[model samples]
Target: MHKYYLTHLQELESEAIYIIREVVAQFDRPAILFSGGKDSIVVTHLAKKAFWPAKIPMPLIHIDTGHNFPETMEFRDKLVENLGVQLIVGSVQESIDKGRAVEESGINASRNELQIVTLLDSIESHKIDAAIGGARRDEEKARAKERFFSHRDEFGQWDPKNQRPELWNIFNGRKRMGEHFRVFPISNWTEMDIWNYILQENIAIPSLYFAHQRDAVYRDNTWLPASEFLQLREGETIENKLMRFRTLGDITITGGIESDADTLEKIVAEVSATRSTERGNRSDDKRSDTSMEDRKKQGYF
Candidate 1:
């Protein structure tokens, strides 16, 4: 399909493949941060295509929040086993047990933020010079300003203002010791683009994305599941909602919307017609408008 005639999604796939090849040609030790999320799954798909006859050269790095859905873990295990790729798990629970981070003290408490410590530790422990992620620009305002080869200091802190100019696809990954680079291949893709690409390539995603009925409680303009962390307040009420998750994170933070878009075509149509951003359902960003930027500066991926 790589010919004179270029389709939009084909172009995006070609670009992503090019970036993956670039990373393989450039870095000595690189790893893909896989969260079993849709974006990361797409990234993993591209990695497989990047080296078709040969195995994927990079390892899959998972930052486990310890509050992840069981389905995601099962998918992670299967994908790693099938792909024959090395899986490096970074556990937030270990960080908490080591007193590096403390568990929150409320009903709605979560271990999402504590993942940063584990992620950084994994990087250093594995001696990974570069970490590739599936972050897209259109996902968030702060993420929109990210560079393709974003640099992190010894402490894994991201400096927004100080970044190398990515002119004409010239990526500067040069760095001193104790520093590493983050490579986001699909930086230009939108949510719609992602769906269209998936539809075009016929890539398989986890089953949780489709429609399902779950016992949920309404709170703070989001339908949170009846997980152990979620508590029914004095006035809050529980309901049976036909819901599906738009974004996956800590069980306490991720939100679901009433949906019946079970098929891929229906999902694409629904997402295209939607008005809100994907992170709208995520309670972590609700802390403040600048919360994401603040967290990124503090080395929270």
Candidate 2:
């Protein structure tokens, strides 16, 4: 008899693949919430491997905030073309124009909270029963309470108190009509695990993750990329710095950290030694102590 063991990366890969397959088996119409971020990129990669020799079964859904990085858009288009999968975009600008979602105001305003309405609208419009996301438990306090298969109400809101139990690796995806589910395939993966797997698989990611010279400004104790959407405060000034993003989001809120880790291996090593959470740079999470939790409850991803 021979005994074999899987490495840490392989185990995580296997677990994610299993969850993805379950979405296919359990839901009628499932789609991936692709944001072109590293976590979503890894989830999309696992989807490719989950159904190899054939095209991915579900379409990729993107809730466009109209504040994206140019690099992220380019990478998203290229990846969609290469994968030969359908891409569905839900535009927040359209939502605002149609009076569906109202944009916030003030110096710290962002489209982050506005994404909730756009996402729920897209879900309802597409009749998507299972919306697969790349949210990890280790990212935030709200995400830590999520299950492998999280259920949502008819209004697309999550009830933390009313969640299903998953014992012995079993998941219950039962839901009523007019209700949907948010499935997280990589819920168990951590930031370090994601980088390790990306390095091991030699996955292609957006250029924003690498160290490069960019115009940025220090705001709220984080280096925010200088963009047209940004309105400078009285004493604010932009300066060129070698920086990289640990996480990617709207250009207005996603902050960058000073780093020289341009390669995948270097990123892995940097992540391993970092002390902050991957989402720590995101200004959206800094709104309040329960910011993410409130968003999740209101159907934000």
Count clashes in each candidate, considering only residues at least 3 apart in sequence or on different chains. 0, 0
lDDT score, candidate 1:
0.88
Alpha-carbon deviation at 253 in model 2, angstroms: 0.1
TM-score of 2: 0.98
For every candidate in turn, the CA RMSD to the true structure comes to 1.7, 0.9
lDDT for each candidate structure: 0.88, 0.93
Per-residue lDDT of candidate 2, residues 1-301 (tens digit): 2558888789889999999999999999999999989999999999999999888999999999999999999999999999999999999999999999999999889999999999999999999999999999999988999999999999999999988888776778888998999999899999888998898899999999999999999987789999999999999999999999999999999999999999998998898898888788898998799899899999997
What local lDDT score does residue 83 receive in model 1, on the 0 to 100 scale? 97
Misplaced by over 4 Å in model 1 are: 1-3
**Best-fitting candidate, measured by TM-score?**
2
Q: What lDDT does candidate 1 reach at residue 253?
A: 85
